[model samples]
Every structure is written in structure tokens, then in C-alpha cells.
Target: MKIFYFTGTGNSLYVAKRIGAEVYSIPQMIKEGRYEFEDEAIGFVFPCYGFGMAKMISNYIKKSKFKSNYFFAIMTYGGKSASGLHNMEEIAAKSGIHFNYTNEIMMVDNFLPAFEMESEIKNKSSDEIEKKIVQIEKDISARKNQLIRKGVASDVLSKYVHKIADNVSKNFAYKQIKVNDSCNGCRVCEQVCPANNISVTKTPEFSHHCEACLSCIHHCPQNAMHLKSEKSKARFINPNIQLKEIINANCQVK
Candidate 1:
């Protein structure tokens, strides 16, 4: 089994690692132009962004070629996953890929605009997380074949949710992230950006093509990055992951 993952603050990476697969970073895979992989089982583990998979993940799924008999996906989100799993199914359908299993796990809500990080962190218990991960690990080891269904109401909601979010995301999501004066020129943001959308000289600069994964904002040591909300929100990094792991996962081209 091989799992390809993209993470902002390492939630997805942690999940991928726990699944006992040969893990591969999505950004690294794209940068190296090595999209073709052969495995008996192929899986994607990523965070849900605005009720859907990250823009980069969708693009990667569309462009990549895979030879696998079994395919699956795991989506991690802080709040409602909404249409994220549904969106992944659609993208896979486009490429003639049918998922044998799909599911989601709720984690610390890090979308600063919607959730207060301090409160969410306190509420996200370690015991709860372990229970979920252990079950997922067992399921994957057994090659479980369950699929996630969003019920009638959720299915109806998902149809328009992603379409609306797509427009908003393309126009607004990435544009809002900005570095303040507190940025110490450490360049940690630059190194951890999975999209490689940030470049740091005196301070960090953003490219137009950011995926808005929020890795830079959450991982900035100085808490220097903020969105247009113009309010100071607490930053969050998965405590189980190291900053070195994030930097290495994203920055290393090969």
C-alpha cells in the first residue's frame, strides 16, 4: 500500500503514517513530476478545505496515473467535512477510479476565521483522536470496503456547497494570507509551504496560485501570518508532529 498526502499542520500526515503505508508527500510528488505509481493499494489522505479537497489535491488526482486494484481515501477536518468526501468521489470518477473505501475523521478545527483555535485545541481530546485513528488503522489493515454516504440532506447540501466554495476559494482564499511585521525573517513559512507559494527575502511573499492550506500561518513560529479577517487568532500545529517533519515533507523536492 502507498498513501499520498498533503497537509497544512500535519493532521493528514499523522493519519497517513498511522495507516502503515509507504507514505509519499503530494507536493514532493508533483514537484518531482513522478505521478505514476504502481501499488496493490493506493490511498489519498488529505485535509478537507472549505468543504472539499484542497485545490492541489484535486489537480494531482486529475493529472496522475495510477495502476492499482484497490483505491481509498481518508479526509480529515476540524468541523463538518460536508461535501469533501463526495467531492473526492467525483474527482475519482472523472479519472475512472473507484474508491473501495472512504471515510473522515474530525480533528482540531484550525480554520481560524470560523473557529477559535484556543477553544478548539482545548476541546480536541487526545483520547478521542486515538480511538478514531486506531479504528482507521485496523480498517485499512483489513482492507475494509465501506463507503461514506452523506445522507439525503447532506448530499443535497454538498451539490452546491463545493461549487460556491470553489468560486470563493479561487478568488479569495489564498489572497487573504499575509505576513505582519512580527515575521522575523526566519523563512520557516517559506520552507513549510506545500504549494511553494511563499518566497521569503526580507519577509514572505505569496504567489497568486496558493492553495490556502494555511500551513504557513499555523506553523509560523512568531504567529506572524494572518488572513484578511484582520483579527488576531491563535495558531495551531499538530502537537504530535515536529516542525522539522513539516519542513522536510513540503520543502524537499525529491
Candidate 2:
């Protein structure tokens, strides 16, 4: 079994770790040009973006090849999962793979535009997360199948909303990210960016290809990275994940 995961602030990584599979970082896979894997069971683990798969994960699904008897996806969301599971089902179908199991886990929402990190963390306790993970682990171990059922209204809404929102987000979401005066040109942001979208000189330079994962923002030691006028908002990184782990997952090839 191999679990492919994409994470921003480590929420998805935490869930992926709990799944107890040989985990592979999707960002590192893309960076190293690794797109083919053969395993008995294959899994995609990632956080939902705008009620759908993250753009990088979707792109990986399109470009990668896999040989597996069972394929599953686990999505983490901070609120209502909306139609992300359904969306993953469609992506799998398009990839000529049948999605065997799909599920969602509630976690802290780090989408800074809409969710306040401090408040979202208060919504779920450690016991709650462990309970959810236990259920997911049992189901995955049993190879249980879950059919995506969002009804007609939800299916239609998710399709259009995800398409439009993903497009808009990709175009403008990372545009406002800038290194403030507190930056000492540490180059941490450039090194941690999963997309290879940041370069450090006097400060950080951002490219237009950013995935908006915010790894740089949260991992910056100086707290120098911020969106437009966002210096006041608190930052979040999953407590179960360490800074070195994130750096290795996002920055190292192996």
C-alpha cells in the first residue's frame, strides 16, 4: 500500500500518517518526476480546496499512472465536506481507475481568507480527531467501499463551484503573498515552497505558478511571510507534524 498526500499546514499529512501506509509526498513526487507506482492498494490523501481536490492533486491524477486493484482517497475538511468526495470519484473515473473507497475527516481549516485558524482549532479536540482516524483506519484495513452520494443538487453545485473557484484561486490566490520587513532573507520560504514558486534574494520572490499551499507562510521563523495586510492573523501548523518533517516532505526528493 502506498498513500500519496498533499498538504499545506500538515493537516492532510497527519491524516496520511495515521492511515499507516507507506506514505509518499505528492509534491516531492512531482518535483522528482515520479508518476508511476504499482501497489496492491493505492490512496490519495489531501485537504479539500474549495470543496474539491487541491489543484496539484488533480494535476497529479491527470499525469500519473498507477496499477492497483484498490484505489481510495481521503479528504480532510474544516467544515462541511461539500462535494469533494464526489469530485475525487469523477477524477478517478477520468483516470480510468475505479475509486473503491472515499471519505472525509474534519480538521482545522487553514484557508486564511475565510477561516480563522484560532477559532477553527477550538472546534475539534484531540479525542475527536483520534476517533475519526480510528474509524477511517478500520475501514481502510477492511478494504470497505463507499459510493459517492451527494444527490443531484450537490453534485451539480460542486462541479460548477469547484471549477470556477479553482480557476479564480489559481490565478490570484498567491499574488498577494509577500515578505514583510521582518524578513532577514533566510531563504526558508523559497526552500519550503512545494511548487518551486518562491526564490529568495533580498526577500522572497513569488512566481505565478504557486499552489497556495502556504507552507512558506506557516514555516517562516521570522513570521515575515504574509498575505495582503494579514500580519495580524495567527498561523497554524498541525501539532502532530514537526517543522523538519514538513521540510523533508516538501523540500527533499526522497
Candidate 3:
């Protein structure tokens, strides 16, 4: 089994690790310019973005070729999964790909423009989340044939919302990432950026091709990265994930 994952704040990476298998980072895969795969079971795990998925994830699905007996996707969300799974199915169908199982897991909402990181971490129930993941593991082990279905109206609405999200990403707060006086040119942001969007010298430089995943901001050791639109000063990275792991999984500099 091979699992491909995309993460910003480690929520999806944590789930990918817990699933247990040869996991691949979608960002790293893109960096290597490799996408073809053959496996008994293949899985995609990533956090939901704007009721859809990261543009990189979407493009990867639309462009890649895969041969597998079973394919699955796990979408980890900080708030609502909404039509994320449905959206994935729609995108996959266009590529003549199908998923055997699909599910969602709620975790800390790291979107700083909306929720406070402290409250999000405090309110999340680890036990409840684990219970859900345990069930998903059992089901996937059995190669269960299940897909999330939604109302036609909502599904249609989601497509529009997804487009809006794409636009939001382009013009979002990170469109012009700011570095504070605290920055010591540690370059942690450059190392953690999945998009290869940051370059470091005395400070960080964003290459406009940003995914707005916020990995750079969340993983920055000095917490010097910030956006004017952000609602709180707090940041988050999944407790189960370490900085080095994130660097290994996402660094495109090398």
C-alpha cells in the first residue's frame, strides 16, 4: 500500500502516519516530477481547503496515472468537511479514477484568519477523533466500497464555492507574506514550504506560486511569519508531528 498526503499544519500528515504504510508526500512527488504508480492499495490523505482541496492536489489528481486494486482518500478538516469528499470524487471521475473508500476527520482548524489556535487545540477531543480513525482503518483494511453522497443542490453549490476558494487562495493573506523583526533569517519557512514558494537570505521571499497551505508559517521556529488578515497571533502544528519530519516530507530546495 502507498499513501500520498498533502499537509499544511501536520493534521493530514498525522493521519497519514497513523494509517501505517509507505507514505509519500504529494509535494515531494511533484518536486521529483513523478506521478505514475502501481500498488495493491493507494490512498490520498490531505486537509480540506475551502470545501475543496489544494490546487496542487487537484492538479495531481487530474494529471497523474494510477493502477491500483483499491484507491482511497481521507480528508482531514478543522471545521466542516462539507462537500470535500464529493468534490474529490468529481475530480477523480474526470480522470477515469475511482475511490473505493472516502472519509473525513476533524482536527484543529489552523486557519488563523478564523479561529484562535489555543481554543481550537483546547476544544478538540482526541478520543473522539481517534475513534473515528480506528473505524476508518478497519474499513480500509477490508477494502470497503463506500463513497460519500450528497444532495444535488449542495454539490452544485460546492463547485461554485470551490472556485471562490481558489480565487481566495490567490488573493489571500499569504499573497504577500510578511516577516517580522523577530526573524533571524533561520530559513525554517523556506525548508517547510511545500510549494517551494519561499527563499531565504536575510529574510524570506515568496515566489507568488503559493499554495497558501501555511506550512511555512505554522512550522516557523521563530513564529516570525504573519499575515495582516490573521485573526490571532497563535499558530499550530500537530503535536504528533515533529519539525524534522515536516522538513523531510516537504523540502523542495534540495
Candidate 4:
């Protein structure tokens, strides 16, 4: 079994690791120009953005080929997953692929503008999350045939929710991130950026290819990187993951 994942702040990577598969970073694969894949069983683990899969994930699914006897997906979300899994299905189907199993696990929502990181961290209990992940692992091992499909009501609501958070998906990189004087030129932002969109010289500079995954803002030790509309000053990285793991997962510099 093999799993491909995209992560910011480590949530999806944690889940992918817990599933006991040969895990590969989606960003790293893209950076290395590795696209075509085949396996006895394959899966994708990623965070939901704008009530759908991240644009990077969606684009990869649309263009690449994943040949497998069984396919699965696990979505990690802080708030509502809504129809994110279904949205992913549509993208894969367009490429003549389908998943054998799909599931979602709720984790801290890292959308800094709407969800306060402190509150999101405090409110979610990881114990319950662990239980869900264990069950998902068992299901995948058994090759479960469930596919997550909500009806029209969910599709309608998902579109509305997605529209509200669409800017998070936009490519206005230079205009999005804000860095302050507290920065010490550490370059953690450049290392953590999945899009290869940051370069540091005394302060980090945004390239036009921002994925807006917030890895830079959340992982900055100096707490200097930020969004202009962030809710609170608090930052978040998944408790089960370490800083080096994320850098290894998304770092474009190799």
C-alpha cells in the first residue's frame, strides 16, 4: 500500500503516517516532477480547503494517473468537510479514476481568519480523533467500499461555504502574506512553503505561486509571518507532528 499526502502544519501527514503506508509527500513529488504512479493499493490523504480539496491536490488528480487495484482517500478538516470528498471524486472521475473508500476526520481548523487557533486547539480532543483514525486504518486494510456522497443540500451549502473562503485559494501571493519587524531572517517560511513561493533575505519575500497553506505563518519561530486578516495571534502545528517533518514534507529546496 502507498499513500500520497499534502499537508500544512502536519495534520494530513500525521493521518497518512498513522495508516501505516509508504507515504510520499504530494508537494515533494510535484517539485521533483514525479507524477505517474501505480500500486496494489493507493490512497490520498489531505486537508480540505474551501469546502473542497486543495487546488494542488485537485490539479494533480486531474492531470496525473494513479493505477491501483484499490484506491482510498482520507480528508482532514478543522471545521466542516461538507462535500469535499465528493468534490475530489468528481476530479478523479474526470481522469477515469475512482476511490474504493473515502472518509473524513475532524481536526483543528487552521483557517486563521475565521477560526482562532487557540480556541480551535483547545476545543478539539485528540483522543477521539485517534479512535477515528484507527477505525479508518482498519477500514482501508479491509478494502472498504464506502464512498462519501452527500445529497444536493450538502452540495449547495458547500458551494456557498467555498465561495466565502475562495480568497484563501487565490494566487495573489505578494498581496497576501505580511511579515513584521520581529522577523530574525530565520527562513523557516522558505523551508516550510509547499509551493516554493518564499525566498528570504533579511525578511521573507513572497513569490507569485503561493499555495496559501499557512505553513510559513504557523511554523515561524519568531511569530513574524502573518495574514493581514488573521483572527488571533496564536499559531498551530499538529501536536503529533514535529517541525522537521513538515519541512521534509513540503520543502521545495530539497
Highest lDDT: which candidate?
A: 4
Q: Clashing residue pairs in candidate 1, if any? A: none
Error of 1 at 194 (Å): 1.3
Best-to-worst order by TM-score is: 3, 4, 2, 1
Please give the distance, in angstroms, between residue 60's alpha carbon in candidate 1 and its true position after superposition: 0.7
Per-residue CA lDDT of model 4 for 20-75, tens digit only, reads 98999988888888889999999999899888877778777777888899999899
Model 2 backbone overlap count: 0
Model 4 earns a TM-score of 0.94
**Candidate 2, position 78, lDDT:** 86
TM-score of 2: 0.93
Model 1 scores what on Cα lDDT?
0.83
The 0-to-1 C-alpha lDDT of every candidate, in the order given, reads: 0.83, 0.81, 0.86, 0.87
lDDT, model 1, position 145: 98
Order of models, best lDDT first: 4, 3, 1, 2
2 against 4, candidate with superior lDDT: 4
Q: What is the lDDT of residue 118 in candidate 1?
A: 82
Compare candidates 1 and 2 on lDDT and give the better one. 1
Query: What are the TM-scores, per candidate, against the unseen true structure?
Result: 0.93, 0.93, 0.96, 0.94
Q: lDDT for model 2, on a 0 to 1 scale?
A: 0.81
